[model samples]
Target: MTFTDDLKKENEDIFQMIFDHPFVQGIGKGELPKEAVEHYIKADFEFLNAFIQVYSLALSKSVNREDMAYFHEQIQFTLYDEVKPHLNFSEYIGVRFEDLQGHPLPPSGDHYIKHMLYHANMGTLAETLGALLPCPWTYLEIGQKLINKYQPTKEHPFYKWMHFYAESGKETEEMRKRLDVLAANSPVDEQNRIKDAFRKSCQLELAFWEMSLTCETWSGELAVIK
Candidate 1:
């Protein structure tokens, strides 16, 4: 199978797992009690804040200039423009990246974000953008699934929160055209470097979600203390 094919398969696997998982299903469909939904949202946001900040710093320190530029653009466009501006739910909780300064990322998190940044700076641009493909693509799939399952209207914060999934410019076919230009100009070695980066980045995302599943399991065994 092609690399993109494998990524789509991986995404399908995760979507199935999350969809079937009782906790996620409950939250997605608004079947979970209000308290449980609030609790899960807190945990999810905590992890995400830690994630984006470390990713930002890691990419900021990347060895390659152009890849670093990609990371910066991702931060500027996706995080600032699409995510932060669109998601009012994030603001209500005050769970921004700044809230997670000095927090230690899981080994999986470190490897995923840093590797992408490193590859972008040093590897091929297809690979650089490829490293980014997982976020928007996976998000797009899940957001569509959720909206199909439960129609979150404009009045609902859930609707606004899911905008990040559909709004990323990278998820468009236009990105492929842009990447094709780089692929033509790039050396063979650089091209392979990008392909490797893209593959590994997808694997990292799979692992991160797996970790979240584990976290959910462990947290569930604990007492619910409000």
Candidate 2:
């Protein structure tokens, strides 16, 4: 079995937790509170900026032209395709882009982005892939499952969101190929590091969902100035 497959099997418990998380179930049921969805979109917007940077770091670290091209393409897609659409959705949901601009990152988002950036900037390519894989891969997995189970209509609140990741889309296929390459070529010594990064990332995915469900924010109260 491939390394990615093995990692998924070993971490099935965490994956199941993420799939069963209230936030995800809410999305599936078309019952997620607007406030919680707003919170999640805002947090995700902040994380995507950092995510783009991680892809850039991967591009810089790429040894071959093909890898560089792929990473660059991913960076573009995250910024233009993913982030832009989410901003539009935010406006649709009554949360302005301005509202998201200065709000502090939720603790879960902060930690997850920091962990991914640390690995993307400082770790080997295989480790970087491990750090990056969970976001898209897990979303795709959840999307497919939700679509199958819910058979949501076009009017469903999260129809577009679920459709975005529902299938083995172009980006998803590209990511799978990248993972296969990494699994085949990465050094034996780095196996443990890769697995650890993947597992921790899956755990963080769960935390992120919980944070959204609870509308978690920074710990201290905000001062009001009039």
Candidate 3:
């Protein structure tokens, strides 16, 4: 198998584990107790908020470099093609970013936006690959579980959104392939930069989750204060 194939396969394995985990199973089936759903929602919100900030930071650091330029383009395409088109209202509700202040998104919606930006700024192709892998993986796994477990009506926003993301399985696989090629062609130093950035991104995600779990409540709109 190609390197990308191997990488995707490994990701799938982990995803499967997550999917089967008791917590995921509960959430997917819409059987999460009120307490569990509350916890999950809060944690997810915080993760997305910080994630977007990291992306913006990466973009700022990218400056005028050629390789970084390409990375930016690829990320933009991915967002346009995959994410923007499939964002569910409930997903947005978790993140209350200023961009949607009038709409009042969830507590953690902005953070999710920042995470996407983070993937765009990863220095090396490999680093980008590591960062980007989670998007398709998380969505695909979650969508499938929701489809199997949840009985949402056609009018439910999440049902339609999840269907769109879930059906893009081929596109997700293609992205992984492209990332592998990008990694192979990137300079060694650039790859290292990507790797470092990926690690930082992961740390940010973890911390965000930790905060969300610890903070029982955050009042006002989740949007950042200017």
Candidate 4:
């Protein structure tokens, strides 16, 4: 099996937790509270902006044109393909998508972005991919599973959301294949770091769902605000 497949194999437990996460279950069931959904969409907008920044950092760090092109394409993918769902959902809730752009990320979202940026700032391209790949990878996995299990239809409240991720599975598979090549070429020490990065990101993925399910926010207050 490929390195990406092995990383996934060792994290089967986390993947299962994410799949069974109540927030995700709620999405599939079309029973998540509207208020929680609103919070999540807004937080997702913040997360996406940070996500693009990390990709930009990765693009800057690329060693060759192929890697550079890959990161560049990923940046565009997040902007267009990923942002569409956020736009559609914001409109559904009567909020301007632009207005959601600068909202404060909830606690888990903040930690998640920080984790991605940490690798992008300090680690090699392999480590960055390890940090970055899981976001889309897990979503693609979840999307495909939901589509297969639920056979979502127009009547489903989040059909568009689920369908978008499911359809994007092809693209996400390409991403994992790319990461696998990169990981296979990296040094042993770097590979270990990459594994840690990948696992932490997987854990964070579950926390993000928990955050959304609870509509998590700043507890007390911040002196200066975003």
What tens digits encode model 1's per-residue C-alpha lDDT throughout 1-226? 4445544565565546544666444425544344333343444444455445544754655678865775566556544555452234434444553442343444455566677666556654466666666556655656667777777677654566555555544544444454566666778776666566656655666666554444333422542423
Per residue, candidate 4 scores C-alpha lDDT tens digits across 138-219 of 8887888888888878988678888888778767787788788888889999999999999999999999988887878788
Give per-model TM-scores. Answer: 0.59, 0.91, 0.52, 0.92
lDDT leader: 4
10 residues in a row with least lDDT, candidate 3? 96-105
Give the candidate order by descending lDDT.
4, 2, 1, 3
Candidate 3 per-residue C-alpha lDDT over 1-226 given as tens digits, one digit per residue, 9 for 90 to 100: 6545555454454555555655545444444343433444444544444444444454555545764664565456554554442234335344432233232234344444454455555343356556655655556756766776776677654566557666767656765676567667878676655555444443443343333334333575342322
Q: Give candidate 1's error at residue 81 in angstroms.
A: 2.5
Sorting all predicted structures by TM-score, with the top scorer first, yields 4, 2, 1, 3
Candidate 3 local Cα displacement, residue 193, angstroms: 9.7
Q: Give the local distance difference test score of model 4.
A: 0.84
Per model, state how many residue pairs clash.
Answer: 2, 0, 20, 0
Can you list the residue pairs that collide in candidate 2? none
**Local distance difference test values of all predictions, in order:** 0.54, 0.82, 0.50, 0.84
**Pairwise TM-score winner, candidates 1 and 3:** 1
- Give per-residue CA lDDT, model 2, range 100-137, as digits (tens): 65556789999999999999877988898888888888
Q: What lDDT does model 1 reach?
A: 0.54
